[model samples]
Target: MPDSPYVAMGPRVAIRHTERNDRAEFTRLSRTSAALHHPWLTAPSTDEAFDIFMTKLERDDHEGFLVCLPETGAIAGFINVNSIVRGAFQGGTIGYGAFAPHAGHGYVSEGLGLVLAYAFGPLGLHRIEVNIQPGNEASLALVKRYGFRLEGFSPDYLYIEGAWRDHERYAITSDMFEAQG
Candidate 1:
C-alpha cells in the first residue's frame, strides 16, 4: 500500500480511494461476508463484477473508498458516495459494507468519520444521505453514531436481492457537521 489519501485517520484505520489492484482481496472478503451481508447488501464478489464496479467509480458521479488497517494494509470494508450532485445540491448518497473479521469491530465507524470529512471538506459536498433497510440495525447504528439524523422513510425505495426493499433515510448536512463538533 502506498501513502494514504486519508483526510481523517485514527490509530487503527486509514481510509483511501479504491484501487484497481484491490479486486482479488475485495472479492475474497465479499465472498466470505455473504452471510453477514445477505438481505441487506451485495458487494462485488467476482472479477467481472469488480471490473464493473471500478468502472462506475471512475465516473464523476461516483467515488469508492477502502477502509484499511493502517499497519497491515488489510481492507476492513468499503464506502461509496454515489450520484453526487453539484451546483446547488452539492450532495450525495452513501453505501458501505464491512468485511468479515472486521465487522462489528468499530473499524467501519472510524472509517466512516474519515469519509464524512473527505466528503464535506475536499469533495465540497454540503450533504450526505444514507438509505438503509429498517432491519439493518448495525448499519443504522453506524450512521447514528456519526450523527446522521433520521430524515424520512421510503417504501420500496431500492431493489435488493430481487425484491424492492423499504428504506429509512438518514442524512447529515455541512451545518450539522459543525454541530457534531
Candidate 2:
C-alpha cells in the first residue's frame, strides 16, 4: 500500500511490475474472479503457478504488469506483454484481464491506454497485437477502443483450459497508433 513503485499512472489506475510480494493478493483475486475469467483465461491461482508466472517475467521476451487502483494500491487486473522482439520486428503480443470486482468499471480502458503509450514510447515497440476468442466481446471491445485493426483469425490458436481455442487477431502499428491518436 505504501511505497509502491509504479511504472505508470492514469486517471483510473496505475501499472507496475508484478513482484513476489504480490502472490497472496493476486492469487486471491484470480480465484475469486474465475466466474468472470472462466472460458477466457485461468490466471495463476496457486503458489506453484504463481512461481511459473514470475519466471516468465525474467525472460527478455516477456513482461508482466499489475493494474492497481491508486486509492489503496490494490490490484484490479493484470496485463502481460509477451514475446517481445527488439530487432526488425519490434513487436509483442499482449494478454490482459480485469478482476471481476473491477470489470465493467472502465479500469481496463484507462489502464490499457497507458500500457499502449508505454509500449510505443518507452518500450520502443513498433507494433502490438492482441488476440481474442471470437465469443469474448469484452476483449474485442477493449482492443477496438484503442484502434487496433482486425488483422485475421487463427483457428485453434492457443490452448486454454483443455482445448485449443480460436482467436481473432487485432493489431496496431506505431504509425497507425500515432495517426489515430
Best prediction by lDDT: 1
Query: CA lDDT, every prediction?
Result: 0.92, 0.90
Clashes of each: 0, 0
- Compute the lDDT of residue 159 as modeled in candidate 2: 94
Which sections of candidate 2 miss by over 4 Å? 1-4
The TM-score values for the models, in the order shown, are 0.95, 0.96
Off by over 4 Å in 1: 1-7
lDDT per residue for candidate 1 within 1-181, as digits (tens), equals: 3454554577789888897899999999999999999999989999999999999999999989999997888899999999999999999999999999999899988898888888999899999999999999999999988889999999999988889999999999988986788
Give the deviation of candidate 1 from the true structure as CA RMSD.
1.6
Model 1's lDDT to the true fold?
0.92
lDDT of 2: 0.90
lDDT of 2 by residue, 153-176 (tens): 999999998999999999998888
Give the least accurate 10-residue stretch of model 2, judged by summed lDDT: 1-10
Please state the error at residue 33 of candidate 1 in Å: 0.4
